[model samples]
Target chain A: MSGPAGGGRAGSVLALVGNISARSLRVWQRNRDVYFVTWKTNLVPPLLEPILYLLAFGAGIGALVSEVQYRGEMIGYTTFIAPGLLATQVMFQAFFETTYNTFVRMYYQRTFDSIMTTPLTLEDVMAGELLWGASKGVIGCAVMMVALSAFGLLRYPHALVIIPFSFLAGLLFAGLGLCFTGIVPQIDSFNFPTFLFVMPMFLFSGTFFPLDVLPRWAQVLAEALPLTHVANLMREAALGRLPADLLRDLLYLAVATIPLCVAGIHLMRRRLVK
Target chain B: MSPVIEARALTKRYGGLAAVDGVEFSIRAGECFGFLGPNGAGKTTTVRMIYCASPVTAGDLRVFGIEVGDRPREIKARIGVCQQEDTLDPDFSVRKNLTVFARYFGIPAARAEERSRELLEFMGLWERKDARIRELSGGMKRRLAIARALINDPDLLILDEPTTGLDPQSRHQVWDRVRGLRRQGKTILLTTHYMDEAQTLCDRLVIMDHGKILVEGPPVDLVRSRVGKEVVEVEGYPPGLVQHARQSGWTFESDTGRLFIYTDSGEAVFTVIAHQFPSERCTVRTAGLEDLFLKLTGRELRE
Candidate 1:
């Protein structure tokens, strides 16, 4: 069943991979075109989000907290949470793009169905959507980085790496979001994952403080969340302090992204192709 | 030249129920072929397979002499489908819809722009090229969908219920545009339940029901062979009129207060029926595809 006839489990997986090509870029291009049309509205949120977080959490809370312990030294509380904000922005941008926005395009706009009628296959369409979702994160990161730099929050050349790093983090969250999009029965059903999965990670993923402050079991759970690795890398870059242990976080993100993206494509195929 | 599309024992099953079961047909190049069936008759499912939107459960289906299951991209590249629903990109303007769709077929950007202009003009949508999809009326949207389909210069075009929900004027306009495409000698496949639509557009067609083809032929031929050249419908028909038709070995159908007689000679049938029934109650008209369709599929409402 698994030989040259292209039957059986392994052959089906191979077929799915074969269906994707550079044509997936066409899907990305479509989203880019639509983005440019409403780019002004898209720009407002990313620009304002970091400033609001900086004012509320960074300056307002930092006044009382003063400083926090980092690698082995004390850093300003405002500076500590600044990079965390950037990391969270990557998560929100990529996650929302693939979940609610992608759902609208898939179910409401019927954009995927239109693209599939051409030479493009379902795999190509979903892959393009993943790439576009990642791009949204990268764009949001850039916009927020500029706003953060205005307050002397991010460091120089080391901070430049955060832009590219956001893309990898973007792909991971985008894949996770698409998996949810594929399973949810309706658009309203997304609230379940948004609250249960995303909200929990947003609050407990070491975004606001160090994991050491939490109890042992809570600390272990925080380490398992993908955002913890993302926040760790962002803090390392923002402070211009690249510890050797940061490689562990980088390896974890790389490992998690590939499988999530593959699963994302397969899960979307189940929803779409029949 | 070989046939443009061929299907042998084509089947598509959703779990236990077969949506399209063992359907066999072939479409010659440069001819307008149609699949006429009521709802749930597998017309849409069959067309979806030809366009590679749905997979075949079993047997063989081919387009442009290539198997649909293998290298679907190649077959899909050569065919354009205007689906049953308005699947246009509502986010983009009318002109952007065409140009962006052209890119999916790997058409060069410059050529895509040039084709977008030409197709918009061809579909009489050149003036509203930049208008958003929501702003366009139903007919305009449908025409733009057809224009978008032509952006690739596809060799075969499949229109699934192209004018399903349209006013008479819009339906006529769509038919005119479709006739224009036919004059350009493109191989077209259309599926419609409207019998008049099939008779007006199709060179040859098949009537399908219960996931099977009941009959296939030219509209006029099917009407003449299955029904007849003419029909005499008798309102307030008498009981002896049915008895007279049966004794004369004439093909007829009886309703509550009407008797329809199918015959090659309409005047003769009308005269004979009117002799027993009132002349004012009988009227003769030319037979059509609707008569043949009803005769084959029955008058029962299909869910």
Candidate 2:
């Protein structure tokens, strides 16, 4: 490598991230392409969990509440809960990459220390990591979204918007993923947070049922969780029928995402440099 | 031209203990300066401050005449550092490793490619350009690290113990490359505990012990000034050698019974050693940097 003897602005902070991210993406695809294919290979199995629930819980239990009406319309039980499952997968995959993968690169691999010795500063490091997380999340969510659409569960005429909404929903989880990485000392610490935070959200974030179906007090608690807002916003956007409380849900998730991201970046800088 | 590196009272403290105490030193343009110290003598700490990786705890430190206390990036941009540890990315090939590091300094892609090839060839790794980092040998890795540090055509190069772990063959190869750079008039600041390496590569050096400077000067001059013109080294531990020499009207210091008797008459000293200590193993030798270091720092190992 030659020194910046003929120095250029191309090595500016922003340019460095863009260049490294571009190179890293190629490395990721070549090295981690197997991981993507492996996740895809097993993806068929995960889809079965929600499909079985819809068939058994929706079809089997629809007989009891066979004729529920809302807004002068009658909807099938399976149709009501399928979108929630899709959003749950987005949260799951996004958070999984952000926590375990990021923790390894940050602590175990010592990759940031190598980069920091270059012209790139701490901010560029954080940006590059976040960009990687977002790209991974987008890939996983896009795959699942296509699979869900194939099942004839949801429809969107403006299908391109689904990509951005999925990215935003994935980013919200990515932010929280980094926040968890900052405090957890080891990869093992990730398991408890996943069990405590991720598992509960997958179970209780109105994924398997409507929020109104819960008791009033339980409904209030669920509303404050970011995943619930993400699931609600996504279900509305995918179905092309904005919910009555759509503004509130979207605003709540937007607020939560910004602070979580800022906090995560702050903690990462402190941890890496320390 | 400005001094290549400058520092005043630079110190680094690990909690309460100072690894590098109030040390002050500087190097001017195109000079090969070295820090000769035993392990834990804070040579590594001093090198880090010049490279602007480790923070200065209390004193002023500058690189390329820029105050590293505030403008580290500006200082770092003009210089290159090869840290003590191997931090190369294992996933990258030899060629990609150099090119990627160049890009981090904002070198253009096309220019970076040309430089990477030139450096890989210079370090005798062009044949292994496509090899992964894990596939390279220890010596190859060290050469690559040195090559990578030079990629930016840095005004100053800071090497922290460049050849400590290499075998003799690899060490000689590295020494040749470093000597080639020195001939190009690139200022180099090096730190090593190996006395031979400091003696061979450095024009002037400072011997540090316990975060303090014990002595500093050109290698040969430092030896001549400290230990006289010549030294008679009697290898085996001599019985009462210090007393024997002093009583014999000669000046000497005994290190674990190895007598280093300094005098202008080297042949006369050996004659006296052979006659006085017939059972003791003896080898007469001219004084060099090692004797000078032993004299200043003593023979005891520092941790």
Cα lDDT tens digits, model 1, B1-303, are 889999999999999999999999999988999999989999999998888878888989989889887778899899898988899988899999999999899899999999999999989999998899999999999999998888888899999999999888878888999999999998899999999999999999999998999999999999999999998888887677788889999999866677788999999887776676665478899999988888888887778
Q: iRMS for all predictions?
A: 2.8, 7.9
True contacts kept of 1: 0.69
* Native contacts kept, each candidate: 0.69, 0.20
DockQ for each of the predicted structures, in order?
0.60, 0.22
Per-model TM against the reference: 0.97, 0.83
The superposed Cα distance between candidate 2 and the true structure at residue A16, in angstroms, equals 18
TM-score of 2: 0.83
The most accurate candidate by DockQ is: 1
Specify the highest-lDDT model's number: 1
Compute the lDDT of residue A265 as modeled in candidate 1. 86
